[model samples]
Target: MTIGSLLLGSTAALIAVSDARAVTTVAEPDPTEYAKICDVYGSGYVYISGTETCLRIGGYLSYYVGLGDVGLFYHARTSDVRTGEDQGTWQNNTRFTLKAWTGQETELGTLKTYTETRVNFGNRHTSVSDSSRSYAFNGDSILTFAWIQLGGLRVGKDWSAFDMFIGGAGDVLNQTPVPYGALDTNVVQYYFDAGNGFSAVVSLEEGSGVVGTIDNYAPQIVGGLKYTHGWGAITGVAGYDSNYESVAAKVRVDINVTNELLLFGMFGYGSNGKLNDDPMNAIDAHGRGFYKIWGGNWAFWAGAAYELNETTSLNLQLSGDQLKNYGVAANVAYALLPDFTVTAELDYDRYGGSAVGKVKASEVNWTNANKKSSVGGILRFERSF
Candidate 1:
């Protein structure tokens, strides 16, 4: 054979061998990817793929039917806004709430964000017809609670620290006749844990409603302290209203009593003694200010809860203010399923003091001899997921 032909034959043989090897080679399978459950922050959390954060989604639906004079007096609308008129007798409301929480470990500490929103449908009976068939829908889609927290620092719309730190007791439909504080507001706050079951908090907030949004640089301030043990807890909170230049304070104690029973008591005091004069605009007499909300300068609340069994419980509460106004609430709650509950409650309230009486009459037209006294009841059902 010629030398050139021999070289061509050798090269062709090498090319054939390479092609055969390439055809026999197999590719390995890609690594399987799946969602991972996150138990660090508790149940219902799942880790986000390609991210360090974990997220949890939860929500609840509630329906309530109120009988007798259960609805708020302002719910009754009249042709004349100045004078009280009979409009509503019964009230009904349905609510749906959605919440989301995200958490991650960061250099600053455990970083977290929480958000909640609510939608409501309501109806009331009015004098305009045998029964007011009108129903209205409302929503707090604009973030009822949306906050970011790193370590102990938090900033956003949150429940007033003055009330949150101290907390409230009982599951009754009607809150204490004399309120200790208002609801959620814009806040910048910090929480401190001292270890050994002791902690503290300080917050700067923007007052809501007629108290007027903070027009000036001054913001409402709140401070609180709490001590908790295996059997009970003691808590105290104080607030300063910048607009009204007023101060309010609340102290509370909770006792486990027994594995199935709990007892609690609370007291509140406000610096605004003028609350009795103009009950509408007063800090304590009406829910006009951020913290102060009682008929007089001081108020008291006591309650108890007893679990009859794993599925049923009973609760009772009694409240009174320096103005002599008194209220009682009792309820029985039963769990129909793991995530569903039903509750029935009864309430009675009595007006006291001349100023408070007049204010009540102006709102509800309780001109009759027994107008100072009111009775109401509520039936509620809730499902959570």
Candidate 2:
């Protein structure tokens, strides 16, 4: 073979080798991260990327229509309340609540954080300057809960332990027809779960708005103890109102008669004499405190919940205060789907004390206060995720 032919053959061999190398090489796929289910806590939780923490986001949409003397529409109008000029009509409220929960395992225990935000639109409690515009957008708080917990220690905005510990007068739509206790406040609380069936909680709280809030640096104190078993539970709660310098306590007992029936009773006592001193409480004369919200110095509440079936339940509450004020509330809750429920409730209240607000200066009544019997009801629909 000639030298040129030999050189061409070598070039062809080199080209073939280069093409073979190109065909064998492949670019590695870009690194990817996938969401992982974190079932350690429960369903709907996923581990955060690059972290051991688990997060779950959820909320609920609730709609309720109020009728008769319901709390949603019975209050006298701020503009013309003295002459009893009020807007007593059908009222509706729609709320969208968003919630988030984060949890992680730590040496101290479970580190957790929770937040709840709410938005409302409907015929809330507002004076109608333009009679035609009764419905509007309204909300009490955008952020109802923002709390953090390390083990049993929790700090942030939460409902009072006094009301939460005892389950709050059954599952009634109108929890406070006779005013069991205050609901909202900021808290620094600690919980202790004794082995077996005993647990306890102590809380230092900053009371909520106007009449309930603490004026000085001294915080309100509340404590509770509970014992639970298969049959039922016995729970007790007590609170010291720093502002009013009074103490209120409640003791409750629950009995699980059968697999489907549960009965409970609670008794409340408070040094409500201070109520007559404050102008705000003077209107009601029951000495309303953050912890003691009953009509008088003593009160009793009895309630029961019976599971009629898998999808239906019946709940009822009967409450009375020392002043002879009595309330009865009953409701039937039916679950339409996994996360949706509808409840209809009826409430009857017989006012024991005069509703007339007495002015220290004159006998003028501030609100259209009167001792009268009233009937109210609510139809509620809620969907939670």
Find the candidate with the highest lDDT and give its number. Answer: 2
> Each model's number of backbone clashes?
1, 2
**lDDT over C-alpha atoms for residue 43 of model 1:** 97
Q: Cα lDDT of model 2 overall? A: 0.81
* CA shift of 55, model 2, Å: 0.8
For model 1, residues 26-105, the per-residue Cα lDDT tens digits are: 87744443357889999999887778899999999999877765425213232333444434444667889999999999
Q: What's the distance in Å from true for residue 286, model 2?
A: 4.4
lDDT of 1: 0.77
Put down candidate 2 lDDT per residue, 1-385, tens digits, no spaces: 9999999999999999999998999977445444688998899988888899999999999998877775423322222445545545667788999999999999889999999999987764544555433445576757788999999999999988988877788888886767778778999999999989999999999988776888999999999999999999999999998887889999999999999999999999887545566554543354567888775577899999999999999999998876567889899999999799999999888775633222321343323355578888899999999
Pairs clashing within candidate 2 = 275-287, 355-369
The prediction achieving the highest TM-score against the true structure is 2
Residue pairs clashing in model 1 are: 284-294
lDDT of 1 at 378: 87
Worst 10 residues of 2 by lDDT: 355-364
